[model samples]
Target: MTAKPTANTRTIGSHFTRAGKYAVLSFQAALTIFPIIWVLSNSFRTTDQILTSIRLVPEQFALDNYLNVWRMTSIPRALVNSLTIDIVSILLLLAVVLPLSFVIARFRFRAATVIYLFFSLAVLVPMVTVLPMTFKLFSELGLLGHKYAIAFIYVAEQLPLSVFLMVMFMRTIPSELDEAAIMDGCSILDLFRHVIIPLSRNGIVTIVILSFVAIWNDYLTALVVLSRQADKTLSVVLGYARNEYAVDYGMMSAAIIFAIAPMILIYILVKNRLIKGMAMGAVKG
Candidate 1:
């Protein structure tokens, strides 16, 4: 009883749908890229030009921003401090969280739900609320302004989320693997090393990437704990940039670009594994 669409009509409908999607996608892409493009363009412009001009491109490209940021600021030290905190915190998170998560996921215990609830509640408590007390404790311990001390705090703050992620991932891994390993005379440590850790590489990598990014970008905790200028992380250093010098837009842009470069490179390298890990966890859980 219904008339079929003519070829021309069908072609027009298809074209419109395609055009609509492309238009939406193009806008989203532009929104995402615009800031980065603006920063890069401004990084090559002089301070006067940046203040006076709204143009996206500089009339004359200059490398002085990069040179000035490197020479004037403690950017190199900040970068190193950020990296050290990120690496140490992540390693500590892995060392502590992995085994505990494995046990919690694999075993049934009377206090399991209670323990899980405790950790879940910890995540709800914001760092800002706890920082005052924590800073006092760190001061009492004489650990304030130390990179390792900051790393420890990062690990503690990050643990709940890391444990939750690892537990969920470990649960998805079959108990049969553990039983088989045991039958072959594998100890708990051996089983974890050989069977569990190997299979959970994707999840581990995802955790590593996420944790690193969080720690690297963290400003509040670092500012609170690292009062020493020499020990300040990249995020903290960037915050103090204006006070440290006359806010050179070009140099500021250059520092911002440098700060984000490592995270961008990491995302590019591990994006596939990260996607796969999330998919696997979501599907299995």
Candidate 2:
């Protein structure tokens, strides 16, 4: 037999649990922020100063490292390459995945289960496992140095997960909405464009943000596919910069900042929308 706890004991246990939760959150916040602060501080100091200094704050601040990183590296071209790939790939994913996911979620076709199973299996296949075959296929297709090829690959790579997520989110929408649209004499295309697309806005936004971040940070695929210095993505170019700069922490830090800033800024701007979308999807799902 189990006994019910007294008010005093319950209150004490709740207090201790709250304290533990707060302690964990504080520790996590510090772990995430400290490295970023340290890097930002070191970016203002010289390579030698960074090596010798033990303090987080720099005695002197200068922009020379940033200037050198911009002028000396192919980062500018890499930025252009990354943006092009990310934008085009995301657009392509939306074009294909949205409609298919809607169909899978709303319809009762015999092949729907089979199709969903196919994409689900794709999610389980590790991307790295096919790098050799991917490289050879792209090379043979004469797309090794083209930005569009990378964009194509990104769309294909991201499609499975994005479609799966959309399907899951779409299922949580009320079926009555579909019935009402159809009763109003809406055609299949009209129903999709007007009812389904608008209703799935939150899920769509979630996929866009996730895909953007994933493509922006991808390095291995870009490196293997884009061999030319002028065509490499930001991550690939950063690797080259690291090799060239070697132990120069100041320039390295600046390069890291440059590579990461665009994505961070994008996230900051859309974070509110992202959080709302995720929360709504979670509750609906």
Best by TM-score: 1
Per-residue lDDT tens digits for candidate 1, residues 40-140, read: 88888889999998767878788899888888789988999888878888888899888888888877798887887777676768899999999999999
For residue 251, give model 1's deviation from the true position in Å.
Answer: 1.1
Task: Note the Cα lDDT for every prediction shown.
Answer: 0.84, 0.84
lDDT of 2: 0.84
Model 1 stretches astray by more than 4 angstroms? 1-18, 272-285
Off by over 4 Å in 2: 1-28, 272-285
Evaluate model 2: give its TM-score: 0.84
Instruction: Quote each prediction's TM-score.
Output: 0.87, 0.84
- Per-model root-mean-square deviation over C-alphas: 3.1, 4.2
Scanning candidate 2 in windows of ten residues, the lowest lDDT window is: 276-285
